[model samples]
Target: MGTQAPSDYSSSAPSKMDEQPEKQAKIDEKLQRQKEIDDWLPITSSRNAKWWYSAFHNVTAMVGAGVLSLPFAMSNLGWGPGIVILILSWVITLFTLWQMVEMHEIVPGKRFDRYHELGQHAFGEKLGLWIVVPQQLICEVGVDIVYMVTGGKSLQKVHKIVRKDEKDSIKLSYFIMIFASAHFVLAHLPNFNSISGVSLAAAVMSLSYSTIAWTASVHKGVQADVDYGYLAHSTSGTVFNFFSALGDVAFAYAGHNVVLEIQATIPSTPGNPSKKPMWRGVVMAYIVVALCYFPVALIGYYTFGNKVEDNILISLEKPEWLIIMANMFVVVHVIGSYQLYAMPVFDMIETVLVKKLNFRPTTTLRFISRNLYVAFTMFVGITFPFFGGLLGFFGGFAFSPTTYFLPCIMWLAIKKPRKFSLSWIVNWICITLGLMLMILSPIGGLRSIIIQAKNYKFYN
Candidate 1:
């Protein structure tokens, strides 16, 4: 039988059916590409994280054990100077952070993923890296050490409360070791984006403990029958103490090192990648930070006056249950926060080890090196448990540059604000303040360390 010619309708129908799957496949492929782009790590991708996540990360970085010292800082500067300095620090830090975000756009088709990169962009690679990287490492590692010491102390406090008779049961070093081991596991998580859940939890824990501390302060203040003085006890003898307090306040607000990294997480919108979301998130986070910080500082100092301990919690004579719970929250928050801060250090070290030293970027290698780094920090914490002095040194030496000096310099270098113009003058003023703080605060901090060393024993 002769084959009948296929009808046009029949031919077209099969053709359309074939094309339907092909078209659908193309659509599926396109969707897959979009998903890859969207699901990519924020460290590498421009836009992956939502602004709220960024805010949570920022808060996690900003709110730490440092907040506990603000009252002691207030005691140093007194209420008037303390409040003024606190506001100024926040304003300057926020402005510098904005400058950092603004500089990201100055060079088209390039993004500054890390603070050191911005430093290298502004200055030569060697000089910029040297200026920023060491300070950043110091600040971050110092913070982790602080977390270890503070967390161990807090856990010890809780232990003493819960086990009253067993107050001297275990050494602080044991608690620090336990904390470090916990951090070792979490620190293995690949990057910042991977820790969003932990960051959010850390932020919540920060708020929880801070609220408890603040409430306790108010209650103590109201119930006490002591004279409240808004100023320091004596101005002349406590000059160094005053600066030490200033260093503490500066330290409390010294999350500027990670600001750009945190901002990197904010997802960019289509056709408009300006930093509106980042700015909004920053403003919101800082507002929450101020609310958390101010009341605690004011009320704690008001309650204890010159008698306030470096950590306000140390001074509180609250119910053992409440204090233990608050300290436990602190330990929990710091556990997550240690990972948050340490991740950047891990990225830096791993990049160098893999790229420069040719170490394979395998999971085992990462786990090993990262845990070793944690071990080193643990050793430091155990060897020197001077929490207050460490805070001072890190805040003054590391934070002064990472938080203040380098940002101004990078802004000046990248933006090249006109000579004697408002931007120039403002940045110069900031630079001057940074230099002054850098020079003086460290000296005071060193003095504090010397004084503290007299009574401090290893693993005490």
Candidate 2:
């Protein structure tokens, strides 16, 4: 009868309106907690940095001990290939760095502060983590280890200069320990922004030492009957040395590994996005990079020819005071470089501890974790301070992907330029070249390591 009085079912409609707010509250709570965690983390803890901070930070990041080795890298490659590759690397890396900065805030209202975060956005979440974390860790951790060796060797150079008549009894291992002690104190700094002063000083030191290196070479003039021939005689040796040289060049163009991390420090607004200022800062840094890299590589190579030591400073024995100053600058620059590279690894370690392992974010936790990390890298650096081999090895193996091709791949995936378009063609070209670098350079580096290791003793 009349559909059972039309069944008053409004209250029983099965709608979730009543439960929606409650569920939303839980979601909000979770998000808030995560934000709190991010705020406590090293990377996202501060966002007050200016554009100039980016400039010096990038300079500090890019121009480190690697610049001192550029001439040696050139010696390995010879004139034609060395100049071409050095210039090519500079252009390619700059383009990729631009891609990274553009992609940092590619998604509206979000920022991929870390390399892996952007990787996650481009690739699927799990796959992104798998792709980026291991590679990023390898690049970052590898740099720390290399810089440990760089800092130690630089300190040794300084000591040799200052104590000219000394017996040279102290081992490089001891110098590495002395260098690691600086990081033990420095690693306690809170975040990227906290270390800006150190980074600025390091950047200045980089430019200064680079200037001294090349100018000193100019002053010294070309070696008597200078030979521009390949350092190795055999074809196989030459090929491997060539490959290792690629790694050294690749290593010279660092800072790509930490570009996004540096960008994360600057405050971003919707109207004036972070990319603009980031790009400006990048341009400044690259100019500084060109100034520091080209002369050091070319002039140093020209002055020494094929006889250049793996570290150019090691080759220069004259003008003792200037060499000592350059060596001291290396020490200071690498001090900042080591910390810059280590910050990401520290972030990773602290993240896992606090979030994954449920450790409290206490000073004691930080003290222990950071100190242990410095100690671990110190141990490795001491064990094998094969600077040239390490430069080539880590440079090509890890750096090639992050610096050379990964950004291009990410750009292609995200931007999706039309087939055969300029963007498409360029990205592919970079990918191909980067692939070659990754495959070839590490082989040379490994061979060099083996040769060095044959007569090497542990921690000597």
Cα lDDT listed for each candidate: 0.79, 0.92
TM-score of 1: 0.87
What ranges in model 1 sit over 4 Å off?
1-42, 45-47, 222-237
lDDT (C-alpha) at residue 131 in model 1: 81
As a whole number from 0 to 100, the lDDT of residue 1 in candidate 1 is 22
Report how far off residue 262 is in candidate 2 (Å): 0.5
Q: Number of backbone collisions per candidate, in order? A: 0, 0
**Alpha-carbon runs more than 4 Å astray in model 2:** 1-25, 166-168
Spell out the clash pairs found in candidate 2.
none
For model 1, residues 1-460, the per-residue Cα lDDT tens digits are 2344567556756776688899999999979755553233335444577778767777888889999988878876777888898888888888887787677656776667788888889898899898889898888898999899999888877887778776458998998988888887888777687888888888888888888888998876553554445344455437777667767876887677777777666665446664777777777788878877888888887788767888877887577778888898898889888887887788788777765786655778877888899999999999988777777777888787777768888888877889999999999998998888887777667778888898777666
What's the lDDT of the predicted structure labeled candidate 2? Answer: 0.92
